[model samples]
Target: MPSPFPITLFAAPNTLCQTLTLTHERELSALKKAHSTELQTLVARIENTSLSTPNISTTSRTSRDLKRKREEKPDQDRAS
Candidate 1:
């Protein structure tokens, strides 16, 4: 059936638009109900994994050692 309102963008309630809205709402509600438990379980697993894992240091130990060597090099040359 043609739209009751002159323009498609108009917000006026039409049978076709109302039917489509109800159908979409029912589909979304069913999907949420079906997946809600699965989504919660997945989230819990992710949180547990993150908490159990140890934190890693971002700075490189090798860089610090190299810097110490460089600082000592000039002092050794002056003494010799």
Candidate 2:
């Protein structure tokens, strides 16, 4: 199976200004449906994998350093 990344469709220079025939319209519709299904399946797999895994921590120690600085501000103001 191909990756679910976005795909671009290009029309020929001669066909660019021309109206699409019924066959071309059908083909375009089928391509769109296939792309949609692929995207849906990829998303489902990602969700299932995430659910099976443990939650990862995203917090940074920098926030703690910032909190410490804020706490020290009152002491500095008293010294002034």
Candidate 3:
């Protein structure tokens, strides 16, 4: 069968244009689905890792040694 419209027609409702639109829509939808799935997986991994960690304490024995070192800096500068 032949097209009812002339061969020069390039407007909407034409088979060539309609096919191109449908193909593009399908590709765009698939890309969106893939991006969402990847985002969800990364979020879950981060949540699990954060929950399994321990709290860091600032009042340990190492901190006391560092405090003594910091206080001696001004005295050493006066001698220089």
- Which candidate leads in TM-score? 3
Error of 3 at 75 (Å): 19
lDDT tens digits by residue: candidate 1, 1-80:
98687665556578779988999999999999879978999999999997886544424566777899999999999999
Model 3, 12-51: lDDT tens digits are 5678788988999999999999999999999999898877
lDDT winner: 1
Per-residue lDDT value at 23 in model 2:
67
**Total clashing pairs in model 3:** 0
The candidate, 1 or 3, that scores higher on TM-score is 3
Clashing pairs in 3: none
Model 3 spans > 4 angstroms off: 1-13, 55-80
**The 10-residue segment with the lowest total lDDT in model 1:** 53-62
RMSD of each: 8.2, 16.4, 8.2
lDDT of 2 by residue, 1-80 (tens): 88699766597755764546766888999999999999999999999999987655523556777899999999999999
Q: List the candidates ranked by TM-score, beginning with the highest.
A: 3, 2, 1
Looking at model 2, which ten-residue stretch has the lowest summed lDDT?
A: 53-62
| Structural similarity to truth (TM-score) of each candidate | 0.36, 0.46, 0.51
Distance from true position, residue 12, model 2, in Å? 21
